[model samples]
Target: MKLFGSYTSPFVRHCRIALLEGQAQGTLECEFIETDIVSSGKLSPTKKVPFLTDTLYDEKNKAEEVELTDSASILMYIREQSGLTFFSSANDYNLFCNVNTVLDAAVNLFFLELKDNILPTEGSYLERHSERVLSALQYFNQQEYPTQAPFSDGELRLACFLDWGLFRKRINIDGLDNLQALLKAARSYDIFAQTAPPEGA
Candidate 1:
């Protein structure tokens, strides 16, 4: 199996963390192909990083290749391939999706500002997304964080998103105490460090 993404993608980071944490590293024979948005455009319909491809053999020994176009789908494929579950409970899965929601909003806003020189203009779609980002952060501040190693998917995803948002200067997550604590704990682990984006990103 192969995973393609950039060094700085939070979505990709979560998948990496899940593989390491689940001890699926050697089992999957996984290869990570570093890619950027421009390159991804030709490889995926979404033109996004973190797509995956794998070769499989059917009962008839027919070889087939498959492509997963998004991180969430890739994650589920990883889980199935690894025989591991990232979510400990339904609530955890819900939390993971919520983090995706806010992170997506922030990323969209960041790109709008970057490529279009647009801000969250009053009553606009971007404006509503801005509100969603702020509201999600405020509520997530009070969430129950993962306390130790082998953190759940939601916990790892949240930490990656927070760090990315900070790195991109897209949002300030300071004062989100619970989330901050989770990030601090995750940072102590070598897997997290190993998956970190390169310096100056």
Candidate 2:
């Protein structure tokens, strides 16, 4: 399997963490492909990172190809192929959806400010986005993520997105007490520490 996207992307990071947590090395080898939106133009279709390609033997006993665009799909593919329990129950799935919703909104706000160069100078709309960002952060902060055991996909994805937001200085999440605690707890994980986005991003 080849994973295409930059390390700075939270979506890509989620896929990477899922791969590692699932222990699907032999069946799914990850190859990180760094791409620039302006130059590569590959991210235009989905306008997102962390697309995946899987190679496997087909019924004809020949190597077949499969392509997955969304991070959710890619994560599921890895879990099913590896037979790992990344999302074990209804609660787990619900939490995963919640975290992903925040991630989506956060990323949209980020692009609205940075990519499209539409940073709100002054207006009620600016306040709306800001509120959304904080609400998402606060929601994550309230969750009780298990610190002693390996993190679930939901936790891993949320942590990566929060850290990226901080690294890019996209939003001021400092005032959110719960988010700060979640970030601190997530830092204790070796995977997060090692896979942090490149500095000065």
For candidate 2, lDDT tens digit of each residue in 1-201? 777878788888887777776663445566767766662355536756778787889788899788898888888988777777658777778767876776676676777877677764455766576677777777666756665437777777777888888887765666777667667888887767777888876
TM-score of each: 0.91, 0.84
Flag clash pairs in model 2. Answer: none
lDDT of candidate 1 over 20-95, digit per residue (tens):
7556445666888999778999999989878999999999999999899888898888887788875679988888
- Local distance difference test scores for all models: 0.83, 0.73
Off by over 4 Å in 1: 22-26
Question: What's the distance in Å from true for residue 163, model 1?
Answer: 1.0
| Model 2 segments more than 4 A misplaced | 24-27, 120-127, 173-177
Judge candidate 1 against the unseen true structure and give its global Cα lDDT, from 0 to 1. 0.83
